[model samples]
Target: MSAQHAAPAAQPLRPARAPTGSGAIGFVGPVLAVLTIALGLVLVRDALAVAGVISGDGWVVTVLDAMNGQTRTGWALAGGIVAALLGLWLIVVALRRRRRKALWLRKAAGVGIRPRDVARLARVAADDVDGVLDAKVTAGRRNVNVDVRTTGDPYTRDRVREVVTARLAALAKPPKVSVRARPSSSTSGGMT
Candidate 1:
């Protein structure tokens, strides 16, 4: 009887999109809202000045006068209304960002894990295996690498590899595991 092997499935090309850093939108959202509001203020100011309520100064001065000017009241009322609306929009954007950042901070506070945790877990697991005399594990942001000093026995090295792989899987994200069986004298050789 012939054994049949299944072909591997093709992987997706694009990485899945994860949520951006918390409060990222908060930083951007307010700036955008302010710009939009400024634009609205400009348009309204121009309209009012054309109608002869205020002098056709730049948008900023025109809008300012429209709000505070008493006698010359052409588009003053409309400009004030538009400015108020823009202010409200800016406030809303700021508030939304603050809320999102608060929520993200709360969540991150509870789920924090450090790279040291990865190294500790790997060392413990490798040391517990039968053939491994000692183990050193280093962890990076998203991965870990381990070095195992063995007692010159293939079985012990294999056991160390297996245990380390299993423990890392349980405690940390799956790390790339490499197993090296070194001569005892190599330990005296300065690690380069």
Candidate 2:
């Protein structure tokens, strides 16, 4: 009997759908945490000072008297407005939902490449071009943008474009690709 080998199954060329995310938590959670801690600390400090547990220079009493004065209406109104705005912002942040960062590549042999992975691939492809000092790729299902930084003395814009275009084309399904070249910034050479 002869040994037989099975060919691998074909992979689909579809981008992965973007993942849904509740991103407000990322912003609101941190802000709320900091504000809560700071405010709580202030309250505790005030209580301790008032109880003679800590020495104070009467700054709190001065602030309170000023706030309680009859002519402080304008300041009170401004403070109220600011507080309301902050509350509104906090609520909006708590309720907001956003898409997680990741592009879905059409199904691969087993797993589809993410936008991040595609970006890395694009950067690699760009870096392979001559004269490239650095490369950064922002990949999406609809487009791929590769920014190449070259040595100041040697420009490789065209070569970077051609190489990136070819590499993207070799993918299962290629999106529209654009390559931009510029002189390297202060940062040292690396792919992003």
* TM-score, per-candidate, Cα-based: 0.37, 0.50
Per TM-score, the best of the predicted structures is: 2
Over 4 Å off, model 2 = 1-22, 30-72, 108-115, 130-145, 149-159, 166-176, 182-192
| lDDT tens digits, residue span 56-172, model 1 | 666766557776845756586789899899768766655563321111112232333456676787789887876667788877545567777766665766677677777655432
Scored by lDDT, the top model is 2
- Report the error of model 1 at residue 123, Å: 0.6
Tens-digit lDDT string for candidate 2 (45-113):
888888898898345676878667567567879999999998998888788767555443443443455
The C-alpha lDDT values of all candidates are 0.63, 0.73
